[model samples]
Target: MSRIAELTSLLMPHLMLAPIGLPMLTAALLLTMKEEQQRLKLGLNILSTLLGLLVAVALLLWSHESGAPATMGVYLPGNWPAPFGIVLVLDRLSAMMLLLTGFVALCSIVFAGARWHRAGVHYHTLFQLQLMGLGGAFLTGDLFNLFVFFEILLAASYGLLLHGAGRTRVQAGLHYIAINLAASSLFLIGASMLYGITGTLNMADLAQAIPQVSAADRGLLHSAAAILATAFLIKAAVWPLNFWLVPAYSAATAPVGALFALMTKVGIYTLLRLWTLMFSSEAGPSSLFGSLWLIGGGMVTMAFGAIGMMASQRLTHLAGHAAVLSSGTLLAAAGFGQNALTAGLLYYLPSSTLAVSALFLLADLIDRWRNDGASLAPYELDDVAPFLTPELMPTTGLNLDEDEEVLVGRVIPAAAAFLGLAYMACTLVIAGLPPLSGFIGKFAMLTALVNPLGLGSSAGTQPGLPGWTLIALMIATGLLALLALTRSGIRHFWAAHDRPTPQLRVMEGLPIAILLGACVALTLQANGVMRFTEATANGLHAPGTYVRAVMTAAPIPGPTTTPTPERAESSATTKAAP
Candidate 1:
């Protein structure tokens, strides 16, 4: 019974979802407010984000202090239990992912504050709902519950994708919605199959019960696993299944696009969690299902995404394609199935989320910057002048060299030039070229794949190494992304998109400085960061700590009946798990 209390405490952090959730709901409702009162929605939107940040921080503290896995409310509408009810589990990884989601969501909310409400119906509201779904996916332990969370996020995403209601965005969103809904249905079918075979909906219960499944059911189990994996792969943007991701991501807004950074990672998280846990057992000598397929497919997926990035043109489209590459990298790491790669994934997840979010937002600013300038490229630039007032082009312009003034449209400020440099620095780190978190993530992947003597060697014929090579070929793909970015950089400092550019403003430096600071800090703290990631990865693999926390207490004594007299034991045949 004490376990119940512990579970509730773990869920305390999830309450952070409410702050974002409520205002978003309010935004949807506030469409009734007179246009003159629209500021009310705006104020509430800002407040909701601030509230979410505080709650997320508080939850992080609670999780830290608890320092153990916990489960919360089996709470049901009619007090149902077991297969009839839903359950939420907060393990170490789940808690960490939730915290990261909250942090990134908070930042995106701040970015959208002034920009979103005017764009479409209940824009901020949908963003909040999306967060709710993301948080739920990380927190829920039940298969059906995860599906519900996945759908919730998709539901919100549909509106956000079409937020501006632009003809192109709306059409793209239709394809996105239709495709994802099919995936969701597949997820549900897979969940039903697992439940039918295992006779339990709880993940922990399934883990213990699946071991006892009959040989007759192995096909069912394997098929279910495959179907479930397909659903997540579709979500993860894996291989040929990922064709839809680029178009949808390209069509979305900067902040909306940034929000997607967490979406696919959530899918990858599900794959890693489900395969490494519940399904694969380290103690057993037998091979686990989908081990080779997942690893090999991951390699192909990485290559596909890299090719997409190389081929894409629009800056937004390029960033979207890069996400595909990142997805493949994540899959490759997970497929390697080594502790180091798993740990690297944990480390990579948050850093990449932040970097991607920052880049997407900056892409917007760059888009506007391009429109203003004219000359060399066919792309739009918001300005053409070499110098402008600080208000318009803060921390922007060409020729970031020390002596030359920073210019955007025409505004010049020393601080602004520093900001442009800062952005350049951040972009470099994200490309995995330097001492930043991305570099560390890549180093871990390389070690896991190529190390002849380490974890890779111990796992005979490991598929993860080949998978890593898939992304390695795309290492130059970052440069492809960098190529488009270089044009803007050159325009700001060396030349305008066409004519000489204008001075930049210090105000615009804010995001550039912040993103660069993250990269620099990540680079400096690589050691400590990698260590924690290792810890996270270890926890994910065995999840012994979590199992113990949930199932640890002495099992409740069941029956008072005496044991039956010993009978001849039958040699019951054992069946292989699917």
Candidate 2:
């Protein structure tokens, strides 16, 4: 009976994730029912999202109550032990990610209904499936399972992207398809390489096993890591590979664009999850891989995104560049791979996603603009109506140009304001500005990076701060990006003279509020959030926690299905605490 209870407790978290999967499955079933089942689909969408959110909340509560990571299980095709079969694990990270996925989906769905027509086939169904994929990716502890989720999402996104009939959309979707398919292929190849090397697919098991592998084989593992990173980087839109972003992001409808924000973050999340555990190289009494490759690469990616953003002319393209900017900034921070890097990454997940997502809705208004600014000149509201109205403007009006007619009908201008705020928030946070979380993360990473740790740790006058040239350049690049973004922000807001504008809707404004609110929340709770992120980063740096969690019931011969451990001691000397 006690065993049964333990098993039940273990299974509960997986049970929580089931709602996400069931909805997707049901969506597939509903597809064959009829074209008139839109209502059913709608109800399912709402029901599934609500249920998922509820489960996420439960898992979070349960995790807190138990004072440990949640565990769950569901055997496939006759009960079989994990190594030969598959299982899911729901750690704190998984639970947090699930909640975020549900939240974003719910908001996007609500906004979608208000705007887009129900003319399409099973629009809600595809959405549910997309949620299913996202939730699956977060919940699954198994690498193969992660791949399954990836395919699920990639397929769903392809369908969603191609929905409706526009020649440009079709063209864009095809391009999106081609690029993503290539990424998927590389992802598959990398997974295959990893499996061949390690012989197991469980992330936890692999984490334990990787550090044990011989140094000679490190080459293969690094190669695999590089390939995997490449796939995700493309998805994340790292420069030199981001040509598809401007066109794809610009072509999508507002709702589509909003949903797309979470898409690339998936890659960033994966990088943090997998690479940190499996590939880091540290030295000395506490060797860990805070990741030194960051300095040059990150700076370059940041510069590229900044250039793209500043150069963009149209609203759509500008939004696209903003997305690019997001990847570059976050990826650069992530590459630093320290306590601060984790903080920035945590802050980034919501900040940039919110900014870019809302910016799209704002841009949509501007894209269709044709109102003569001469019309609404008399009213202080009219000049700012396009952005201030219920549709485009968010609840926060603390930063608008009052009395001046400059903000009228131009969706781009309003979007520009939102972008500016979002950028300033992100830049401040990322560039490590004082009184902001970004500054804290940057400072921490610089501590780790230049040390004989080589990136941040320097001799004399600093225990944490390193005097590496790369670190200096990163600081410099961040300052430069900050200046450029802020200057552009001033132009977008202050440069505008009064002009006539149109009204906005409640639906449109919600995204902006949600996004900006996220920024505010991150700022307000930086200390607490950083504490949690410290916990997360500790788990990331110390593979044992991850390994132990995944390998809980492994056999004596040890993790029969896990990939062989590689570079085991490289991270052994590192000190990590959440």
Candidate 3:
């Protein structure tokens, strides 16, 4: 074999480490650079993000081609055994999330490059650190490590949230920071309690041990799980706990707001991961413990979010509420615990996230134009000359003040046209209207819920109330979003009085175009994307394949048999007491 081929083969096994490690290195490099080194900062940020995206895409394709979750990549750092040393599992779900994170981070970074990055110190450093945390969380197979990454990302987010110093930004950042600190405390307490009971922090190991939990300890275990679920639910922004989401996200600078979109989904991802792995049917009596609560809470969240969307007068707040609605829909589907529903969720997840992020960026641009003082004011009826079509007026008579009159009959500004079209695109996608990826994803979900059996199944099995309820709420929420977005659009686009056309730079506009273009591409390749999500859902429903894949990744150095219930109980007691 050629030298290059040999080197590639040698490094292939370690490729899984690149996503997390590369960003850490880049963040350190960025931290040491001087603040005024904008050129170096921009180049390094783009290079690191591009490399991360490439690696993420490679991992995604590798997982897809492998065709089975069990065959998905599993790398045991330091060649350590399962459930002992750190393990990184690259299954379909994680790979997909990694890809999404990389793509979103890339876009946000590029958009920030347009100017947001310079608003504060260490912007690039914090950005890279944020990616490091996000990447580590998605890749880590250990719960404790998940918490570590959670804090890492949260810390980075604190700095990024206040990146551009302003009164509104500082207040929002404080609220965000305080709420997350409490959540972190809950995370630690819950994780410690679980560790005491199960004597394991590795997710695969916990999955194996959950079914063997003694009845005497079930109450304590349930309490720990509840506490942990509460923390996750708060982050996921389920109704009552979602008060902080809008203010923080809406107040953030445009690029940072785009990054915050993924932060919300991280909570959803954690809930799905731990709940399915630890509380599935394989875990015996603990199976589907909070399913009903999840469904009901999710429904209520959707209702509340819909109300918020309707009440919102600003585009940013409207987008924020849309995120809350998206989380509710996904959480409810997850609560249903059906492979078909999950498949639809996987499809919808990316489509909704990307659409909402683009909306945040678009909102910033439109706001700039509406508030800019230098641009020409909107055309007024009083500023126009009443025309009788005599067509013989002197050219000098037509000459008027540039700012006060429209010499060339009403002309639509290019920036305004761009914003208008982008707004329409965002509305269609966020509202799940037809001919976009959003509609297809929701349609897939509706069809799956309505007909659990394949399309050719025999008659007599109708969808339950839960399924129909979900459908109704989804439609209602979409309509609410439509109404809210329409009002905001009209206020900004048509009914405007003295608003100026915002000057949009190519750099800023390009990122928005790329994100929307991606949505279009996802719609064009909907079939393939659906197939992949279907496979992902199937793998999630049957998690044994995942557990086995991780467990068998390396030698355990002992007997492979699971411990007996009595022995496991004795071990649990001994560990809990210690």
Best by lDDT: 3
Task: Kindly indicate the candidate among 1 and 2 with the higher lDDT.
Answer: 1
Question: lDDT of each prediction vs. the true structure?
Answer: 0.63, 0.60, 0.82
The superposed Cα distance between candidate 1 and the true structure at residue 527, in angstroms, equals 3.2
Whichever of 1 and 2 has more TM-score, that candidate is 1
Please, what are the lDDT tens digits per residue for candidate 3 over residues 341-432? 78888999998899889988887777657756211121221222231112211132222224422212333349778889889988888889
Clashes of 3: 0
Model 2: lDDT to the true structure: 0.60
lDDT of 1 by residue, 10-99 (tens): 566446445335545654665556544445665665576667657655654554453332322222222344444554555556766776
Candidate 2 residue lDDT tens string, 275-325 = 666654421211233244443455566667667656765555666766666
Q: Rank the candidates by TM-score, best first.
A: 3, 1, 2
Candidate 3 residue spans exceeding 4 A from truth: 1-10, 373-413, 455-463, 555-578
- The positional error of residue 115 in candidate 1, measured at the CA in angstroms, is 2.7
Candidate 2, residue 325: CA error in Å?
2.6
Candidate 1: residue 59 lDDT (0-100): 55
Sum up the clashes in candidate 1: 42
Show the lowest summed lDDT stretch of 10 residues, model 2: 370-379
Judge candidate 3 at residue 555 and give its lDDT.
Answer: 46
